[model samples]
Target: MEKAGSPLEQVRSSIAQACKRARREPGDITLVAVSKRHTAATIEPLLIEGHRHFGENRVQEAAEKWPALREAHPAVQLHLVGQLQSNKAEEAAALFDVIHSLDRPSLVKALAKAFDKTGRRVPCFVQVDVGDEPQKGGCPVSDLPALLTQARESDIPLAGLMCLPPAEIEPAPFFAFLDKLARDHGLEGRSMGMSGDYETAIMLGATHVRVGTALFGERPS
Candidate 1:
């Protein structure tokens, strides 16, 4: 098993290799280090290694973990990748550079209110439920156009689309679907892919990939 330092090295190597395989410049794809289940101590080395983008999957946990780290590493760009609750929208808006899970209008309204209160336009990605999983929280692909329109009418800067593929299907098609959706909607960033299928994601034109275990090893239970 790789130690934390080696894991970071390996992740950098993988990013380089993936970019090369995709015939994209190494800088084309941004690496969002998924920092949930990781303490700031474990993340510090990566910050030293010049990794600036970090992603968290929960509002409460990330709200607790990021403050001091943000103070020490002010250049770090934090992203919220989990299911965001309306009640937590203000706190999330204040912290995250990008919110990657806008699945509902209520959450969008709350984020808009937060942005209004803070006077900051928070960039966001609408989550599309490509698989239609009942347990998941995302606007259906059919509902996406309306949602994107709603976002455009709101104060939130609609940046892109995000999705989690059905557990059984290959992620490539789902990612390609997102890429096409973004192009159709005139959006820019596509935040798809993760530790398991990020290479496929790159091939499908993922602008940002959220990688956790592949970079940090298994989460400590």
Candidate 2:
């Protein structure tokens, strides 16, 4: 007899609650609903519900769908939330409104060139490997300062820092560490947190949270 809330409503409610607990204004957090691997048809409902920020993992995949999606919903802000190859810098810069995986010097140089050519200064969050996992996409912790310097020299618009805490363990410490790193660097945007641990991230001062499954449900096999 009682109706269940839609995923968007539930996610928004959770974020609001998290902000309340964190003593932060909900408007301060940019909720990036990661639409990676999901088709445009699957994403339309959230768009219709007025959620405009979305993240994609691959350039090719996004190139396939986002043009039309953006045409239909003109306010949509597309984010690149995966590892970006230097070779695809031009395309990525041309397409995405924001980028969250700027990890290395080469990619920074590439993005700078792309931005100059496109004349579009897309903001980017430098990804840091806080967990130091060899297989992950972020640069190692010690490399962040140099990376940020390179990004600045290249004139890349540094939004802040991002990180993927190791899975299957407590993530709060990692989030807190990222917050400290951002403060040390005088960066305002901390693009940390995801579906599972976003609440913890918000409490630790994440300015952006990339949420997927929690908003769109699990991907099909």
Candidate 3:
């Protein structure tokens, strides 16, 4: 944990340092303060500080917390960073500015119709199973190309690829693999990294980092 500054301030400073180390611009990286399990009361301070990018794990929770928050600060960018259920496609598409969990054919089909119905083309990241973790929700590594094609055919905006590195492992290689996959697919955005390894992700070309604990502390059990 940072010893000298508030969480948000410390994160910003770390992002700056990481960008410096990577020879990249800090402005090029999007910091998504993951606010799931946190009350709107806890999140409002970050909003008041001009932290406009936030992420939520569930559509219903976000719907309950953010409408009032966005009403107060209209420019907030909400990202759906959790595994989205195909049934919740409509609500998720309606609520989030970005959808980072595009992983399967059913979801692609569902979101296509949802986006058409809502007339909102939300930018999406194709979640790749970088760790090949069966417990995870991403598409299999071999299935990525087909999924990308499917999403493109549906006219979904392919922002990039995302992954959750298998926990309790060195994450840098996984981040690098996701970045390479993005490049090979002609995508620019790499939604890799979390609170623990975001700086490494930045150095490896992550355009979006989903930070939660380092900012808000661990989610309460």
Candidate 4:
């Protein structure tokens, strides 16, 4: 039955199975349907079926797409799952319910100011470069404590930790390490994993899984 339904149903079934395998309730994890580069038409069917949580990588794209969707269905929750720029902090804060890429000190300052000015404390996940890739958009593991301190001092509501492991390697260790970091920091949210490794992430205590291609099919280049 799981294999015969729409993508949404299939993804939900998979989540349930993953949760059962991990000995955790399906409700313990938030499945964020990553809708970046997908059109509003592509998203409406899922929305019609009551999938409220959606993630967009770019604030501009979300702005272009979501206003109409939100107008029709007011309960949809939006998340910023991409690297954010300091210059777009206020716009991102106003548009997104959660920011998953709170990595650098500059962004910390920008988001803090935006929240302070707007009186909206958007929940943030401090992204850590667990893969230690210079190209990835995350704070180095060594610099994580300091960044967390700065975020705390700046009054950004720290939701938890987020990470992306290096490509072409086993992600379980990285996910495990991310869980440990969240544990050590007393954070309950671990926004790790994607379509490929979300089951493993759930087993490792991930509170949120950002899934894209698995649910929406492949993205165009």
Candidate 5:
């Protein structure tokens, strides 16, 4: 196995390689450090290294973590990258800069209501079921057009699309498909891929890559 470098070094190298392969500038992509299951202690160094964006899976955990983190790093941006329950919509709306797993209409409606009450337009990314994994929560590809239509017609400000590729397949094709979908719909962002496959994501036009283990090391079991 290849040895991993320091988190910031790894990110810099990966961004360089991805940009080279993609024929795009490294600055075009945003690296959203996935801090799920990681303590603030583990995240501090990366923030100090100028990583401004972090993604978390659980709202409760993030709500507990971010306030202190914000005091330390006032410019940091937080993203919610897991399945969001409707009951937690308000908390999520208040905490996340972007919600990357808006799969169903009910959640969209819940988010809209939350935004209405708070008077904040929480940007969202529609998750596409590209792999059609039964275990994943996302809108089926066939339904994406209609979903995009609905999202566009609302006040929610649909930012773009996100997806999790099948574990066995190369992620490039799926990432490209998502890029195409976004272009077809006039969406401006694409959030896909993770630590294992983020290079392919960047090569295929992923505006945001959720990097966890590659940056913070594996989650403690």
Candidate 6:
């Protein structure tokens, strides 16, 4: 790995280069720094550097961590980028500014109720099981249409689609497929890509990339 400037700067430069090749403006892509397991101290530098978008995996962790952080950085936009339980709907709705794992009818209904109770409609990207991986938390491609309808009918503001491709394989095809899905659904936000293949994702029409390691370095195991 090359040591030059801050990790944040390196990631920004990489994103700009990717956008250049894709003929898209860097401003068009939202870089969601995944801060699931990171501490407030770890995240503060990025916040100080004017990075407003950050993603957390669990509602409880975000609730515990972000209140104080958001109090300081009022402009911060928090994104929930992990599997959300139906039971935690209201809390998740109130906490996250954006949701990237709305993948099923139950979650849709729960979020709808949550939105109604809280009167805050957070935009959500329906997670699609693009790789058909059983272990992943996403709506199967066959069930996506119905789930989408349910979400819309429940009044959940659809941001677009999100996915995690099968690991250790060429991800371009999966990213391209997600872009096609977004196009077919007439949605503009394609939340695909991560630390490893975000460049390919940009080329394939990723409007949002959930990157962790590239920005914050590896989380301690």
* lDDT for 100 (candidate 1): 94
Model 3 per-residue lDDT tens digits across residues 1-221: 32457789999999999999999999999999999999998998788777999999999999999999999999999999999999999999899999999999999999999999999999999999999896789999999999999999999999999999999999999999999999899999999889989999999999999999998988977
User: Candidate 2, overall lDDT?
Assistant: 0.93
Report, for all candidates in order, the number of backbone clashes.
Answer: 0, 0, 0, 0, 0, 0
lDDT string, candidate 4, 18-130, tens digits: 89988999998899999999999999888888889999999899999999999998999899999999999999988889999999999999998999877889999999999
Q: Report the C-alpha lDDT of model 5 over 130-168, residue by residue, as the tens digit.
A: 988847888999988877777766678787999999998
Q: Is candidate 1 or candidate 4 better by TM-score?
A: 4
Worst 10-residue lDDT window, candidate 3: 1-10
Name the regions of candidate 4 deviating beyond 4 angstroms.
Answer: 1-4
lDDT agreement of model 5 with the native: 0.87
Best by lDDT: 3
Residue 219 lDDT (model 6)? 88
Candidate 5, superposed: residue stretches over 4 Å from native: 1-5
Q: What TM-score does each of the candidates earn?
A: 0.94, 0.97, 0.97, 0.97, 0.94, 0.97
Against the hidden true structure, what lDDT does model 4 obtain?
A: 0.92
Instruction: State in Å the error of residue 87, model 3.
Output: 0.5
Candidate 2: tens digits of C-alpha lDDT, residues 119-178: 999999999999989688898889888999999988999999999999998999999999
Q: How close is each model in CA RMSD to the real structure?
A: 2.4, 2.2, 2.2, 1.7, 3.0, 2.3
State the lDDT at 34 in candidate 6.
99
- Which candidate, 2 or 3, has the higher lDDT? 3
Model 6 misplaced stretches (Cα beyond 4 Å): 1-4
Clashes of 3: 0
Ranking by lDDT: 3, 6, 2, 4, 5, 1
